[model samples]
Target: MTEHDALIFLVALATLLGMARLLGEVARAFGMPLVVGELIAGVLLGPTVLGRALPDVFQWLFRQSTPQKMLGAYTTVGVVLLLVVAGLEVDLGIVRRRGRSAAFTSLLGMILPLAGGILLGFMLPDSDMKNPNQRLLFALFIGVALSISALPVIAKTLLDLGLFKTDLGLLVMSAAMIDDSVGWVAFSMLVGPMQGNSVEFHKLLTMGGLSLVFVAGTLTAGRRGIDRLLTRFADELHGGRVLSLVILLALIGAAITQALGIHAVLGGFVVGVAIGDSPSLREQTRATIHEFVTNVFAPVFFASLGLKVDFIHAFDFRLCALVFAVASVAKVLGCSVGARAGGLGWRESIAVGFGLNARGAMEIILALLALEAGLLKEQLFVALVVMALCTSLLGGPAMKRLLYRAQEEDVVALLRRGGFVARLNATTSRGAIEELVQILEPRLGHLAAHARNQVLEREQMAPTGLGDEVAVPHAAIEGLEEPMLALGLSSDGIDFDAPDGKPATIVFLLLLAPRRLDEEVRVLASIARSVIDPRAREQLMEARETEQVLKVLAESAQRIAEERRARGPALADI
Candidate 1:
């Protein structure tokens, strides 16, 4: 556009950003996801509120001219960056570490919702279909939309519950990651041939082939090239140069996918996955990208979703209810069934189901794509938005309630049996680990050497230090029949290369077989919750003897367990 349009666009951007952040903070204050408030900001600014109350101001601010197109371009860039970050967040290593349960849960989670969505698509009346001739295409979009899970939402939920680093959290996040990639790929395939109305089989195959080639080629050779570039640039050039290269790479990837006729998101996402999977990628590099994208691009993108739909005029109670019911029921049933089949108990399975059911930014992105592609009408788009918001709102509370009774049981019983050391002789993480392992050699027998090596190796992969002068070093050992935990206290603190850069004074060493992974998670959660209290940790640190240390541990564990039972197990809140 013109100079006038440019000025108005800047004004619109500023207003959107200000409103989005304010509302997002408000949502967080009430224990709701920040996206909910961002969404509300959009509604207040869009046709529903401002357009109705003050038509002249709304028209001037959000003029349906060149300004709208400019904003759309900005929104597109925001979406690309957001997808890149989401891709960066996916740790393929976590997927492998969580194992068969994650595989089964991810598989069934996609399959069931996809099936349900296709069924729903078939049942919808002709009037609701945006493109009546492209019924199959619309059906596929629905399947993909309903099948996908929001990684950010699920991660946030787990963080709130003090389970982000626990086995259960890892499993859920892994399964959701798989579900996300699969759904996006499926969407790319289905939406690839939506250009001219009549789905060209040959064109669809061309796009699909191109996508596969791009993903495989980039993941192998392209990944190495990107890694080398990052390493070289980081060593020679300034840190900001490396950040610049990352953004450049993301844009290139997005452009390639858009040219290939698939969505630009898939390209950015694939590149992100490759970068994240690389061993050479630095935490600073990740932080640089994340800080810019999350704080700036993400809020703008999510808020823009609200600006598109007229919530008041487009809101259909029946359609909203129907979409919500189908999406939630299909996801919960699919995930719960998958969890049970993978050998989880009823409660755990139910919790997993709820965890995966929360749909947030991803759903909004997909729905926006569908709306643009003529697969969704305004009313249905509104319905999908409502469904996504409701599902996201429902997940955390449901998980907390499902896991409520579980928090009452003995948390320190197994740890109390393993052993506790009041004074640790070592002043470094490796030395402390060796000392702890030596103390347990008599009880471990032949497995002690293997356990020690495994623990050291796991630490090398990623530091176990959890900050607050505490560290939990754990490993999945081959010979262990049940979970084992040992505690060591260092009065002067020891170097563990922790994220917080604080020396670790408390160390909880854990070893468990693959079969006892769930048990390991329970014990970790117990220790994690108990350590929330500074006095609890302080009491243990100050204890002069083993007997005093055990008493402190027992009392802290018991206090947390009782609080969990009386209220809810919200360790973050505590």
Candidate 2:
């Protein structure tokens, strides 16, 4: 409130943000997650290093409630935004596609680690718990902490290992989403009713009922309404407006949960899931929201993790080791068993277990909240963060050590029965996509709209125009069993915004099954190589009939297959 306090707050924020960003870049350069650097920045600036070395300087800069409060406000909004971004990664359709395997993996994954954590919690000294008598609450807190998966960390790991679109990658991601969802809900139930000075059974019961209603309404009616609204305003909502709308949604969601005594982040997360799942939210818009939040706001919050706790003074190696061992063993065993039950081979299942073992940002966030809530001791909090960082760091390398491969197919061979659009009535890109989607409607059935939207979303990310007289519009659709292609000929030509400013006379609507990143890459490569040439485009446009189009493509496919055979298996295969 004072002028002196205001000046300190501004200067301190500048220092934290600058240090965090600098260290984050350093971490990225060293092949570590940027959060690692950001956390380090906090550690150096906080009590761990700076306070010990320069006590007076540290006190002068930070021993003020006004600065801490100002910083807290930024971190709070930052965290809520981070949660929304995390929710966006929760693809329910991916869950459906992976189905039984994901369910089994997530179920056992949560159970065993949770049990191990509870046992570990009970065995700890009475004085070690934040509240000596709240054994059940502490145990439950530990259970959720160990059982939860960090989806963002797991995703980045999979991507780094080049397995993100493989069946195993998709499987791990799906299972992790389930684990994250369950973990957050369980955490809220444990913490929500205990917000006041006293904990009561009636309050817990009330919180439980309210939580169920919130989740159901959000997923069903809230989810549908949000989708329709976004669809209606898709054209109008851009850049600053979209960013503003997302923050507004996150805040509104946070308010609802915070009022119910649950953490505000859950509201943002639930809203994120709804918005992210909507086909109307283009990949471009998603990326914009993601980049801004993660870059600007996320570092500040993750960095604050270091500021709050002294890693050196509070760390109990014995306790840390015990927690780490129990969590790791329980999670691996549970997930591996579940994966096997879900029909994966033992080796692949084990690898999947390791991949999903990463606790990452989610664990750190949860641990901090519990610590602030007086449910976790400082040593326990340090141990959980250590475990999360270790698991995340190890997951990618572990998956890389294991073999990862997906079945590859030739796209041209699938045009035998259907997927051939000889002459298109639509002269615009959007109309072309709609017409093609309708042609494949019988096959896609309920997923036709989903297919169309995904294609449109991908298109919006980057124009698919191949720069000749050819354009390939494609998307990987969830639940689609196989690759489908619809070749549409436009005599008047349609503008696809190609690099060379050439209008496309031949358009290929390619639909690929989800979890086939390799297949998608190969098919696109084959199409670009075969049809992007001037002569090939002229031939395709000249022969606009279905039979002639098939003949030309079939020949091209044969030639391409022979060339690939001569060259041997690609580097990706190896």
State how far residue 261 of model 1 sits from its true place (Å). 1.7
Each candidate: RMSD: 3.2, 7.4
Model 2 gets an lDDT of: 0.81
lDDT of 1 at 542: 84
Expressed as tens digits, the lDDT of each residue in 1-574 for candidate 1 is: 6788889999999998899989988887777877888889989998899888998998898866888888888889888887887887688778887688999898889898999888888788888877788787777778889999988788778867766666677779899989988887778877766655777778778877888899898888998898787667656645677667777888999999988878998988888888877766654466677778867777777788777778988888988988889899999999998988888887888889999998888898889988887778899998888888888888888887776544432446655667678789998889888888877787789999999998987776656777789888888888787777788899899877554557899998887776553465566767787787888988978877667766776788777668868876442351
Query: Could you tally the backbone clashes for each prediction?
Result: 0, 0
> CA lDDT of 364 in candidate 1?
89
TM-scores, in order shown?
Answer: 0.89, 0.75
